[model samples]
Target: MCVCTNRFLRLLIEKLCLPTYCLVDCDPYGFDILTTYRFGSMQMAYDAKQLRCPEVCWLGVFPSDSEKYCLPQQCFLPLTAEDKKKAEAMLNRCYLQREVPRWRLELELMLQRGVKFEIEALSVHSLSFLSKEYITSKIQGGVRI
Candidate 1:
């Protein structure tokens, strides 16, 4: 985790008392980053409780979004062998099952789809597609799992 992200998370969770939402690529590495934000990394396990943001929720660029929003097929990338291995390892983490099983399901869906896409892919429609449309629609429709 970057020190800036850690500091910002701390500020958001501790000082602001606000819920955090993550918007990341629909891929193994992105899922890992989400887990780190919610559960804290093992390397810093000793301070996990304070660093972890239990109120954080995953907000989009889900595998299903490719079809939902009509994003161009060219924007999607095939998952590599390393992506699969990392995703499988993440699927086995106890915290996922115990704390947020819904998130695990999404990861499983990504593996099943065997594809990944960046948030920027939404820009295929327009520059503000992500902020002005995709995110607004998802939030308004209660799409977050």
Candidate 2:
């Protein structure tokens, strides 16, 4: 593959046919970040086809991952009214329903559970858990969506 330089991320990744993975928190905001990376923002809707990266995959930390990784109960924070509102609005996005139903379902599960956690929550096990274990295992085991 050629050096990427400052080329548009989506175009560069597509040109190189690179495998992309997005690791974000289990919160609504993190999900928004992931979707923005995949679909571009509403403000950029006009340029979406050229800027979007449809191949990018969700890597974590999923709501279910809290249980899978054995995070303690205290690490979870109850979703605030604002968080609930954001999540509810995201669930209505047509692209989520049409293109990534699994992701939409995860968000639904997060809302139903009424809790969210940051990526740092994995540190409860150990600081190294995120890079050395969680991300490594997720990719190696094909656990990402």
Candidate 3:
């Protein structure tokens, strides 16, 4: 698993060539990821051109996730009003289930069930996927091939 800032993450996203979708936990943090990936750095990238426009979208936002997961204090960064609203909406989404917490449900379930199904879990069966393109779409579609 790779963890990085929006700038570094944007590089990986632009490398991918696919119809990308962003699946994040339904919380302030997750919404921030979407916002960053879509709107560009809310603070840092202000001086530079935005990497890409929003092409990525949220996949699932599980309410059970909030109850089950514990966000690290550092990751619990502040959120704008819009971020909170979006997170709430995502949590209430009908498509998402409380089957697992959004933050670590996949990992917890794998241990409980002895099987792991990650987006990367399908890498073997699927063609290669690029993280850069994934972010590009969500950040902005202005990226030229």
Candidate 4:
């Protein structure tokens, strides 16, 4: 992984005008990373700036998605007390479970078939096309792509 310090990430964000990306990893770790990013404590992204808190958005991680995609036998870390409570709180929130879930489901399907897909899995042509489509769609929707 090309992990960077929070300070470096902060500088990169400022210097390179990088998107405030919130990655959707496996649920438990994903949440931990999100917390670290918000707190600017991640050893990775060590240079990530806390100039101002970036908007932390949750991608979907619904129970239904979990049911369909999660590998029951996979070893998963137990949630921290805070994480458990936060997850519960999220469940109580309106529109509980949001985008991560879909991605997770896609990942799970790939895993079940013994296939691996990474960000770089996209072909150059596909990447450019999708990027253009994504940006266009975002613009049309008045959302940051």
Clashing pairs in 2: none
What is candidate 1's lDDT per residue for 1-145, written digit by digit as tens? 8746776887878888986778999999888888898889878998887777777788877887788889788998999999999999999999899988888888899999888999999899999988998888877887775
> Candidate 1 — which residues are off by over 4 angstroms?
none
Give the alpha-carbon lDDT of every model: 0.86, 0.86, 0.42, 0.42
When sorted by TM-score, best at the front, the candidate numbers are 1, 2, 4, 3
Model 2 agreement with the true structure over 1-145: per-residue lDDT tens digits:
1113213667668688878899998999999988987887777678667666788899998998877888888999999999999999999899999999989989999999999999999999898989998889999999988
Off by over 4 Å in 2: 1-7
Against the true structure, what is each candidate's TM-score?
Answer: 0.91, 0.91, 0.35, 0.36
Worst 10 residues of 4 by lDDT: 115-124
lDDT of 3 by residue, 51-102 (tens): 5335554553333322233323332224456654555554553323442234
